[model samples]
Target: MWVPVGSMFSFIEVLPLVLLILDAMEHHSLIRKQQRFR
Candidate 1:
């Protein structure tokens, strides 16, 4: 299957934001768990 350049470019641009969001979520969850243990 052939993909359009614009679509591919957009996906690449958005990938980092998505990864950052996921990393932030994981960090938040870790903090919450640590607080609960106290």
Candidate 2:
């Protein structure tokens, strides 16, 4: 399988962005749950 080097670098960059978005969504959900419980 052949992959472009530029695409590999872009994927690496986007991977962290995706993770950050997921982490932010999880954090927001947790905050909402805590606020509802309070």
* Residue 6 in model 1: lDDT: 80
The per-residue C-alpha lDDT of model 1 at residue 16 equals: 100
Best-performing candidate as measured by TM-score: 1
Residue 1 C-alpha lDDT in model 2: 38
Model 2, 1-38: lDDT tens digits are 35698889999999999999999999999999999998
- Runs of candidate 1 exceeding 4 Å displacement: 1-3
Question: RMSD in Å for candidate 2, one decimal?
Answer: 2.1
**How displaced is residue 26 in candidate 1, in Å?**
0.3
**Which sections of candidate 2 miss by over 4 Å?**
1-3
Task: Write the residue-wise lDDT of candidate 1 on 1-38 in tens digits.
Answer: 34688889999999999999999999999999999999
Listed in order, each prediction's TM-score against the native is 0.88, 0.82
Q: Each candidate's lDDT (Cα)?
A: 0.95, 0.94
By lDDT, who's the top model here? Answer: 1
